[model samples]
Target: MDDPMQTVYVWLDDEGHRTVLLFALAAALGLASVIYFVLTGEGSPTRLQLVLILAAGAVLFYVSLRSTAF
Candidate 1:
């Protein structure tokens, strides 16, 4: 059986993998923000702020992936 960690390392070592990883992270953050917003009805100000921050992070990561100034 192939080692999963080794496979992951190999995949990340390939060109464009950084962009893929950033995209995945951004997607995860976006999903988390949406889920939090849906699950927490009448969320506190702090919670809302956290969700906004997560969404912002997701957008920034996605933009960075598309940027040439990596």
Candidate 2:
């Protein structure tokens, strides 16, 4: 039987590194969002711009989730 509260997969070396990188990227993106909001001061981003940002960030998020590549 396994401990339901603990994730065994995360203990693997590869998964651990990928998880760390994803968390780092997520933290950086969060900071950037904060800065953007602070600087822009509430002007709404255009639909095109929003779509582009989301697409690019999704790619980055996918990359960060990989175990084989950084």
Candidate 3:
């Protein structure tokens, strides 16, 4: 059995590299979206656009959780 009180660090070790990459990809996508919207003068992002951004974030979150899971 594992030590119940031992803290699991998610973003502070070798496994964190994958999580960092996922977060980087999400950030890049978000930045590109903002740039495109600003240059095109789109008053608001469409539903699909928002969904895509959220999807990227969700994927990152999922990966982080999976990595930390025992």
Candidate 4:
């Protein structure tokens, strides 16, 4: 039987690296946005909104880290 975890999936061949990088960049941007909001209090984002943003950032970061093949 083939091990799913061992399966390698490439995204556009060379673009796989870029995809991972993009995800990481997105995560960083999301975190930065949250920090800015918290520090400056310029924008009025509700607690739920902040939590959602943080969750999204975490998910994107995890995806980037786990995207070894793609």
What would the TM-scores of all predictions be?
Answer: 0.55, 0.41, 0.57, 0.41
Best-matching candidate per lDDT: 3
Ranking by lDDT: 3, 1, 4, 2
| Rank by TM-score (best first) | 3, 1, 2, 4
The per-residue C-alpha lDDT of model 2 at residue 20 equals 69
- lDDT of candidate model 2 versus the reference: 0.62
What is candidate 4's TM-score against the reference? 0.41
Q: For residue 25, give model 1's deviation from the true position in Å.
A: 0.7
Clashing residue pairs for model 1: none
- Which stretches in model 1 have alpha-carbon errors above 4 Å? 1-5, 43-45, 48-52, 55-70
Where model 2 places Cα greater than 4 Å from the true spot, the runs are: 1-13, 46-70
Please provide, for model 3 over 1-70, each residue's C-alpha lDDT reduced to its tens digit, 9 standing for 90 to 100: 6654443443345566766777888887777767767787778887756876887778777776787565
The number of the candidate with the highest TM-score is 3
Clashes of 3: 0
Counting only residues 3 or more apart in sequence or on different chains, how many pairs clash (N, Cα, C under 3 Å) in candidate 4? Answer: 0
